[model samples]
Target: MGRSSLLKRIFALNVAAFVLAGLVLAFTPATVSAEIARLEAAVLVLVLAATAAIDFLLLRRALAPLRRLSGLMETVEPLHPGQRLPEEDSSPEEIRRLAVAFNGMLARLEEERRRSVERSLGAQEAERLRVAQELHDGIGQSLTALMLQIDRAARRVPQENPLQGELCGAREAARTLLGEVREVATRLRPEALDDLGLANALEALCARVGDQSGIPVRLSVDPGLPPLSPEAELVVFRIAQEALSNTLRHADASAAELTLAVGDDGTVTLRAADDGRGLGDSVPGAGIQGMHERALLLGGTCQLRTLPAGGTEVALRLRTAEVVA
Candidate 1:
């Protein structure tokens, strides 16, 4: 029976016990005679008092768990996903039900917290990408021009002189600096994605990822896949980039595959699959989360799962936006 029904029954029983005590006091005429009357009266009072006390104790026992439940609930903070009601194994059925509901609420809260974190991380990456693009378009180009100018000027400086050796060293150092800047800029944002379309950019990214990481990348893009909007292309590029990065950082897999496709109705998909150890629910990296938010923002989904054949697979699917001039 429910706790409320049980308490109702207890209330009815108490009322019946009091009514019976009153009947004994009024209806027993022979027992009410003088000395016998006093003894009966005393017995009736004691019995009634004992029954009332028992009822009070029973009600207290039943309600004690609820009091504890209230205390736990008061301590719970809605914003704090980790805070939860304490387990109450010995609690009454209603108290236990309340505890179960409270824990379920906490679980949902934790899920929301994770999503919020994912969105924040995605925003950060997007900001980094914007900065990278600015550097590539402005600062990086200027540096290249500066290097060329310096090289031309060095050639004009008299040949076969002592300063020529020092100038050669300086020129070499400038070249090194130029390469380093380009590399850093690429790490922040791939210029290929901006200059070239999605397909060609991804091919270059995969080739370099394989060469640098020593993890062979097998890429297969659909030949007939239609061109996607720049926004959609950027998302695909970022997903592939982060997924390959995961393989390099976390996946012990010797190889990975990147697959891209486009549907007639304009659905674009990118998949990065690797044969490496899977990171369970406790993925500490912001990459997976960033990919998820990017997917969500573009009316799509991103999934990270352990491949059935023993690897980690990250996939992104998005509705392609109409291309604009």
Candidate 2:
């Protein structure tokens, strides 16, 4: 029975016992009846007090498991998936059943999360590849041919001719367009990341952002860090790209820093910090949310917070083994 219903029934029994004692006393001789009535009233009071104390203890015991379950939930992590609540042999039957169902639900959720991340990452990479290829083969080659033709036509024109100036201008414009095309291609997908490694790719990224934004960027990476799976590498690279982009666009800072460190226990830490205006109760943008989702998909943690002094910091941590492809 529910604890409340049981308590109500016990209270009713107490009331009935008091009523019966009063009725019995009413039929007895006058003096004796008064004395007996007083004794029964005292007994009734003691019984009610005892029952209230018992009810409180019963309720506390029945609810203790839920309290423990809540505490365990607070510590659960997506990174370390599939952990189950403990079902002790001594636990109440209801609590054991609850724990079993909770564990099953967690398992299903983790599985769905895995599938969703894989699908998302696959689609993202495929789209990037397509865009990069089109930029490189279509627009890139067309612009190159145009630049060559413009150069040839400019050469054929007389140096003193008025048309020479316009031809030269046309060639310059084509060259600028070609440069932009190459930049777009690179941003779509960094070939260096696939050919070289994370370090070289990140170094190039830092240099490009600094040169373009006129904001100095410093990069520090651990030399002895173990190599990560390709999927994990991509996730880290993309997150760093987004962080730097946000810094350049919104930070309004003169400098930024990126750090990649590997711990002895195989945990990889990535941090991006900038000296600029702080977040200050503002909501995160889509780019930041995307970075966070990507990290979670790979069983990693991403945190963005304002520094105590000023500016903002983006931090990510994940164990290498947890992100195996």
* Whole-model lDDT per candidate: 0.75, 0.82
lDDT of 2 by residue, 1-325 (tens): 4323334544665565556556544664423444567866666566557655655665666667778987987888775675789976566566667778888889899889888977987898899989998999999999999989988888898999999999888989988998998999999998889999888899999999999999999999998677878888888898899999999989898899999998888889899999999788888878987887888877788999999979889998888787544
Q: In model 1, where is the ten-residue run with the lowest total lDDT? A: 1-10
The 10 consecutive residues of candidate 2 with the worst lDDT sum are 1-10
Off by over 4 Å in 2: 1-60, 67-84, 323-325
TM-score of each: 0.56, 0.79
Scored against the true structure, residue 139 in model 2 reaches a CA lDDT of 97
Q: What are the C-alpha RMSDs, in order, of all predicted structures?
A: 8.5, 5.8
Question: For candidate 2, what is the TM-score?
Answer: 0.79
Q: State in Å the error of residue 150, model 2.
A: 1.3
Clash pairs of candidate 1? none
